[model samples]
Target: MAEFLLEALSEEIPARMQKRAAEEFSQIFTSELEKVGLAHEPANCFVTPRRIALNIDGLPLQQSTVVEERRGPRVDAPAAALDGFMRSNNISRDQIEERETKKGRFYFVKIETKGKLTKDVLPAIIETSLKKFAWPKSMRWGSNSFRWVRPLHSILAVFEAEVLHGELDLGHDKLVFTNMTRGHRCCGAEKISVDNFAGYQDQLRKARVIIDRNERKRLIQEEAKKLADAKKLRLREDEALLEEVAGLVEWPNILMGSIDEEFMEVPSEALISAMRSHQKYFSLETLDGSLAPYFITVSNMPSDSTRDATIVVGNAKVLRARLSDARFFWDQDLKSKLDERVLALSKINFFDKLGSLGDKSERLQKLVPTICEFIGLDNVNGAVKAARLAKADLSTMMVSEFPELQGVMGGYYASADGELPEVCRAISGHYAPLGPTDACPSEPLTITISIADKIDTLVGFFAINEKPTGSKDPFALRRAALGIIRTILENKLRIPLKQLISKSLDEYPHLTDSNELLDFINERLKVYLRASGVQPDLIAANFEAGKEDDLYRLIMRVKALEELLASDDGANL
Candidate 1:
């Protein structure tokens, strides 16, 4: 048994591309090894901005020995046919043996070949691996026209203790590999030799670089949590932001910084979005759930700057400028009439085949009353008014500048428009339960508007044959579907999903083939049910056996069916 370590060091790979590159590299290598009869256990791949590394253990040092069998022409065939068979198998007539078959007699050649050493086979594998490497976007650099995600800086192709030297010299100007790598770009700045994977990781760690992303994320979380606790504040839990930042740096140093008093006056959401989207800083919130005055920033460099003042002042200045622009947009948006802007949405195209935002808004205005009655909303007019204004924010300059603030700005704009308090609240609440565990709007008016808004999106997209394709949901239809599913189930709404989807589609006569869309919606429901630990067969059985308009009733049936399966004498047969 032997181990292999392959590393491709390049300029910073995009965070999104790193994971796939690592995964595909290992898979391709393992498959190539297996093709040559080399058996292996699981291999691991790790990725960072500057490099991708793979290590495989329990791999055979040589291909397993095997017998090769070749079938030839029949025993009584013509001389030419026998000669052709002998040529194909590279054997003489004397080497061939006759074998009896049901149809006729055939000649056979058997040969045993010695296992090839891993050392001799790996260079060809490495060369092929480089050629077959898939990059989301690659570029040609230097005299050679070979394209790569970035300029291929170095290729540390080693097998066990040997360097596996080859003709293709891989490196940048004056940067050559002699079985060596550099440590922390900041700390050592000098190249060091490594004989194995353990030496590489240890040396890199000593130089201030952490190879594992999970380790960096853990350090950031722990240090940020400590800083938040010390400040008597809470870090806004943004796992997506945390993961992105974790991948962006080789070394992470978490630092606490305070926002200016004026900037803190900006709405917490806008402030947080500004900090997160631009600066990659995590916002802290006060115990009362208001945006705290402080934020946490992670640096790739060690906290060794004089008094750590360089990082602090630089980040604070950047954050202030970002927050200033946010405040400007907020004030500018508030001064305009939100209701007047709702009329302007008529110009903004929702889709060419479909109508504009205004048309969609009008549809919601009509649909909301019906949905409100179905949901038993106490204030029918309020729900309809909120639905009409909710999408109006899409036309506002503030939302245009900060797309994350669409629903948020709607709530504020509705309030400024002197609408009912409940209506204004519903503007924000209409997009509730964006994810499975995200909060669902329980308020009657908000629930009505929420359902009307989401159902419209689902029907509109599915009607256009733009349904999501296996994790490639560019239009976010999956999220919208999940939101609708969560809203209906959590609110315990008795309204039929299919009926609402059908009713919404009926309004858009241009959108034909709606029955297909309805079927897709039902499929999406099964996904949600399976995720909630419901038996997939039970969901399929219920969908096949029952015809219910209410989503909650369908889900309750699936849940009851699952419970029945869990009992002592439950019959699956």
Candidate 2:
């Protein structure tokens, strides 16, 4: 058994792309290894903003020779066949052997394949993978036609505790393989030498780099919480933010900063989004669950109390500037009534092919009443009112400044405009069950408008034949479909899928067959059920979306059948 390690260290990779790039680098390399018949344990892939490294263990130093028995033409077969077999295998006829079979004696050959040295073959695998690496986005720098997620700095490749000799071509330049890697750009040792993965990780750690993203996340989370807890404030626990912040630093130093009371009066969501999106800072909550005056940030700098305070003060200064801009957007947006902005949406195109957002807003207003009537929602007025104002915030200055606050700013403006509380809630909650973990909108007005909003967009897009494909969903139609499914299941609404789709489709100018859109949602149902732990076969066996379009009833049937299949009688049957 032998060990192989590879590290591609470069300029900081985007936090969003680091983990995926690391996983892909490891996978493509291992698969390339597989093609050359090198069997090894799973690759241990580590990632940070600066580097993606892989350590593969238990690999044979040389591929084991393979022996295969070949059946040739029969003893009396044509001479051409014998000659062809010999030529195909690059072997002489004398190398062929004779074997006795039940029917008759037959000509056979035992072919022995010699194995190549793992070290000799490894360079090609590494180079091929590096050349063919798939990055979501890549760039070339310094007049190099060779593109990477970032510029190539160095390649560290070692096998069996020896440096694997290789060089990677970078269009105009080249990266020679080495056994050395540098540590933290600012703090750690400038140069570190390593012979194996164990030593590499240890040396890198001492040099102030934690390559493992999860460990980085753990450190940030635990330390951020500790910093917050000491002041009797709670860390807001934004997992997505935490994952991203972890990716931004090789070494995380948690520091807390104070917010001004003036900015605290701004909606917590706006403050949180501004901090999160602009500064990558974590918002702290008070013991009573109100937004605390303090914010927590993960810094890449080394820190003592004095240095920590300096870092926090600097971050706080930046935050204050950003928060001031956010407050300005909020103040500017409120000068006008929420409905006064509705006309401006017409200027904002939903898509060139589809009409303006104002058109979509009007469609939503029309669709809401239909949903209210279909679902017997008595808050028809509030639902329609909410639908009208739901997208009104899209044109607001605050949402333009912080797009994450689109629906959130709408809710705030609706409350300021003194719209019904239900309407404000409906507008804010409409984008819900954003992903699997987010809660579905349960309130009547919310459910009414949200479903209407999703349905209209889905049907219109499906009509345009702009459906999401295998690798791409530019419009997030899959998420919209899943949101619809979850809303129905969680709210136990007895709405017919096709009827809802058809009503929403009626609002569109084009009328394609509704089947494709219906099927798309059904496929999403299969996905949703499977994610909820319903067995695939059971879902396939029980799913009848076309015949039973009522999602609540459909899921109920799936659940009942699942229960029956678990019983002894149903199991045997």
* Candidate 1 per-residue lDDT over residues 1-573, each given as its tens digit: 887777777778887677778889888988888888888779888887788887877777788778888888888889999888778767777888999999899988887688988878877787677778878899867766666799876677667777876534333333233466665666756876776788888888888878887888899999999999998999889998888888788888899888989976667778888898889999898899988889999987877767467888889998889888989988888878888888899899988677999988988888877786677766877777787788999987768877888888788778777888888788988888777678988888888888788788878887777878877998887777777777778778888666677778877878765546556666788888787777667888899975656778877887787788788767643
- Model 2, 1-573: lDDT tens per residue? 999999998888999998778888888999999998999998999988888899999999899898988988888989998999898888897889988999887888889999988988898888899999979999999978888888778999999998887888888888888899999999884888899999999998888898888999999999988888899888897888888998899989888889999998899999998999989999999999999999988889777888888888999899999999989988988999999999999999998667999999988988888788777888877887898899999998888888877787899999999998989999998888788888999998899878988888788888888888888999999999999998988888888777778777777766655547877888899888887888887787766444567878878888888889889988898
**lDDT accuracy of residue 239 in candidate 1:** 90
* Candidate achieving the largest lDDT: 2
* Predicted structure 2: lDDT: 0.87
The TM-scores of all predictions, comma-separated, are 0.92, 0.92
Lowest lDDT 10-residue stretch of candidate 2:
540-549
How many steric overlaps are in each model, in order? Answer: 2, 0
Query: What stretches of model 2 exceed 4 Å from their correct place?
Result: 68-94, 100-107, 509-516, 535-546, 560-573
List candidate 1 stretches off by more than 4 Å: 92-94, 167-178, 305-307, 416-418, 462-465, 468-472, 497-499, 509-515, 559-573
Q: After superposition, how far is residue 2 of candidate 1 from its true place, in Å?
A: 1.9
